[model samples]
Target: MSDEPLSIDSTSNEYLINADELSTVQYINSTSQDKVLVDIGFYTATKKDLECLLNSEMFLNDSVMNAYIRILKAQPSINEREDGYAYLETTYNANMICGDTITSLRNKEEGNFRLYRTSTYLNNDMVFFPINIKDCHWYLVVINGRKGVVQVLDSKGTATRRPQLHQLVIH
Candidate 1:
């Protein structure tokens, strides 16, 4: 992938400003003269042009789309409680090596309420009765030895659930 930023022509459309030229002109005007006169042409992109630009090879690709999807999925669902409390939870990998808990919390007006992992069992044989609250939702994430955010549930009701396991061959 090219590291260079995308460029758009701003000559024909009056609403568009050439950022590079504007910056250069602004710098020169600021340093040289008390009053600066400038005539700049602006460019406007139509909806069809914008769509075509977005779908172009420079913009549309696996890496770009994947990044967009990741950003979109990263947004968490917000829930409001009747007791003037709001809850937010997002799944994170439980790092067995680091012994870190996959936890989440809400930034409340009073204070933050955090939920952390108490313990973890390998191979999905252990039964977990972490907590049960009607007002709060549960977020479960599965991870490997390498800590990474994998599949996650947005929200789960107050019910007992089991962990899922997948076998993989590591070279």
Candidate 2:
């Protein structure tokens, strides 16, 4: 992608833009790789973050998935649900969980990643987890507490998300 400024389509009503957010969007498009582009509560996106968005071949990173999750949590449909929705970011340490023994990890001895805090997703009816496996693909795991359902949505359709599912079961 060229260093051309990112252009917003004025006709799209899907975005909820304010002066500050819009400025960040514009800056990310034109800024150098070293510059920080977006920083919104608990997540930061640098110019390097734009690679996933600009290049179709690149894997979507944690910043982008978390950013999208943040936006999803803000929507009316999500909030209007009877039990509400919560989201876990991409860096929730699914890789570590996939390893042989999570006994030590589950005891909270693992360094505190934000996902360790239950308050973020504990009380919600549905929790959305965006998990990136081996830096190759991302899958969205939706746990519907009210309905007693665990759904995994994967674009590739062949990823066996068994380890992540097993961890969630005991979590």
Candidate 3:
């Protein structure tokens, strides 16, 4: 958590050597917190690098969030799925169907679970489309169109490698 800022030598400055009439300020920090190292540099950043930075937790601050909201408002809506699925018109074709799982939540209400298996053709497309599954609600399947399989289970939950696709069948 040390905020010590390092200074760059004014004599060895590259921009000064080129006689560009520019002022450059540089800072360097070497520290580790929670097994994560934070290194930040200010300069000209490329679009791809900026995108990577946006996805990082460090960019979740108020200033970054406000900037992102402004940019999103200016951009067109990228969502193109008709069924309200995020990835309806992409190259991947996916379908959502009824599953064979019957599970009860902690509330003791019996509920039916539907499974939307990913097709080989749309495996890569899944990256762009994510299925939103709340605790108890209708699962929206996008990319293609059609339900796949079903699983039956008790209220108790189980964890799987891919929780979205696999239902932990509680006996």
Candidate 4:
């Protein structure tokens, strides 16, 4: 796709921002009920405009994911746990390599929690991330550092094209 700048809160930036590293952050939702936000704020589309997409079903390209992420950032009660903490998709992951130079990213609106791949990302309280194949489905995996083990949690049920979602985690 296009390597256009990342935009969140109506502001665009040159590169991606790591949501995991951010200590404090804010979010903004598009209140225009009739229009749908496109990838990285490409264009505001009307529901009728996206009718042919998503198997000819009218859909919000990636805005629903954006809203879910906003909830994760705006309300800790959604993901933060008293017993264990978790991470979500980050803005930096927006450009994650998919097949060749292409990225699986569809939204640059806000809040992708994919942590930086470094020892710093693996805190004493956390664990892992790796690739694995299971039942003909390859998982975008993580090694839970805190638990000292590798694991995969497919949030969207089917471990297919859209398997690597960051909405829910079941420990």
- Give the candidate number with the greatest lDDT: 2
Pairs that collide, model 2:
none
Model 1 clash pairs?
Answer: 13-42, 13-43, 13-44
Over all chains combined, what TM-score does candidate 1 have?
Answer: 0.20
- State residue 23's C-alpha deviation in candidate 2, in Å: 11
- The candidate that wins on TM-score is 2
Regions of model 3 farther than 4 Å from truth = 1-75, 81-143, 146-161, 168-171
Candidate 4 total steric clashes: 17
Can you tell me which runs of candidate 2 are displaced by over 4 Å? 1-29, 82-90, 93-120, 158-161
- Per-prediction TM-score: 0.20, 0.64, 0.20, 0.37
Mind giving the per-residue lDDT tens digits that candidate 4 earns over 41-145? 422443333322322223333334444444555676544566455554432233242222133333462125233344345543442222222223323455465
Cα deviation at 38, candidate 3, in Å, is: 18
RMSD of each: 18.1, 5.9, 15.1, 15.2
* Superior candidate under lDDT, 1 versus 2: 2
Worst 10 residues of 2 by lDDT: 89-98
